[model samples]
Target chain A: MISNPLFFVFIVVLIIWIGIALLLFRIDRKISLVEKEVSEALDEK
Target chain B: MFLYRLVYVLMPIGIFLSLLWVPPANILGDASRILYFHVPVAWVSFLAFLVAGLHSIALLIKKSEILYREAMAYNSAAIGMVFTVLTVITGSIWAKVSWGHFWNWDPRETSIVILMLIYIAYFSLFSALKSNPNRWGISSVYLIISMIIAPFLIFIVPRVYPSLHPDTIINQDKKIHLEASMRITLFFLVVTFTLLYGYIYKITNKLSLIIIKLRSSHDI
Candidate 1:
């Protein structure tokens, strides 16, 4: 079953999943930036 | 406790992967491999939504700070999205091999899409509340309404819709007949994903708490 052409499709989807995961990871990293900014603003007060 | 839970979840995944490398296959043959991923994602997504709905109920009952409720909503929404994406990927692969298409608009597939959209909307509502503290009530109301809609999306819609997904595994309409070994592997995978969901939830919840405190203090 893994030999079937559908397996190729799965491989493509797997790549896409990896890409999305990486993108989400980057977005989450930016969330930390936002948090830091919020902290700095609070400290100013 | 967290370390113990982590070990418990990982051991099964390790064993399952080892079994995959073995020559003689288990109960469901190659199809059983899908159990390692697909079932876990489906189970975890369901569990996340359940958590979200429960938290919504708690917020309504207790009327705690909007921050706590938002944390619950955000964590659930994030996990739900990840699991939903996983379900689509795994299910599509399974379908292509078994049903000869990437998609068939099957009842299960359609219902899952609908479920995914609902969560997407949930997340969007949360994002909208970020600029205005007063919007907390609106977000909470949305969460409550979404919770009310979840049961229908999860159960009723799938069953009622015409689907190519197998309705019966063997002689029974509900039970799938897999060898004991495959069943054990699948059980382990489900447990592993559930634990992973819990770990992620905790981390996200903490982040949300910190953000809330930061916001409140800054406003002062």
Candidate 2:
């Protein structure tokens, strides 16, 4: 009963979604950091 | 900012609906839940590719400045490639559950594989042309050609060749095969995925713009 492949499939999908969400969040954060740095550089100029 | 927060709320609801709220299909059972993710991701991939293709056309026509349009096309293609890969992954899992195999060279499967290869080739060409003086012109032409072929690969080939894939929402009879609850849930998920794609596209484009700005300022 505990070995149902359906359960595994659901888990796999959930994991994929979580991974994608994390990747997007990371990209957004990194881009924000870069933008801040660029604006600061422009301001200094 | 409000839109970003909206995604936070809506995506969770979409997840909840797909994983818990929607009833199982009569035959595929719980495996049917993957449809919510697979279909939306595939749709977004197509949308992203379309955006890329349109930008390519505009780039060729305007010829004013290549950077912005080229960047937009690049970003859109990148997103399209990512989403297409996701579609394949989710579709494969669904297939494993239903077809007892991950792949069997079904027409629908073959078409998607061909689509993936096309985009992969595009990326390879893009990188290979990095130092070429006419990179923008060459890549734009390539993207335009890809855009022309995309529809045939996605829609026509799948229908013309017999497929093991299930009937689409609008089949030959021009009727929806989904139940009301399923249809609504699918629609909600699609909208959520589209919004998610839009959000990603906006940020990525902004990043490109900022980089261009920085580069121009540096040149000055």
The TM-scores, one per candidate, come to 0.73, 0.89
Model 2 DockQ reads 0.42
| Off by more than 4 A, model 2 | A1-26
Q: Which stretches in model 1 have alpha-carbon errors above 4 Å?
A: A1-45, B1-28, B168-176
Q: List the residue pairs that clash in candidate 1.
A: none
Q: Chain A TM-scores, all candidates?
A: 0.71, 0.78
Candidate 1: residue B52 Cα off by (Å): 1.3
In angstroms, the error of model 1 at B29 is 4.0
Residues B47-163 of candidate 1 have per-residue lDDT tens digits of 888787778677767877767786777688688789889899989988887788999988778888988887888778777767886665676677677767777776677667666
Cα shift from native, residue B99, model 2 (Å):
1.0
Question: Can you write out model 2's per-residue Cα lDDT over A1-45, one digit (the tens) per residue?
Answer: 238555565576667777878888888888888889898989899
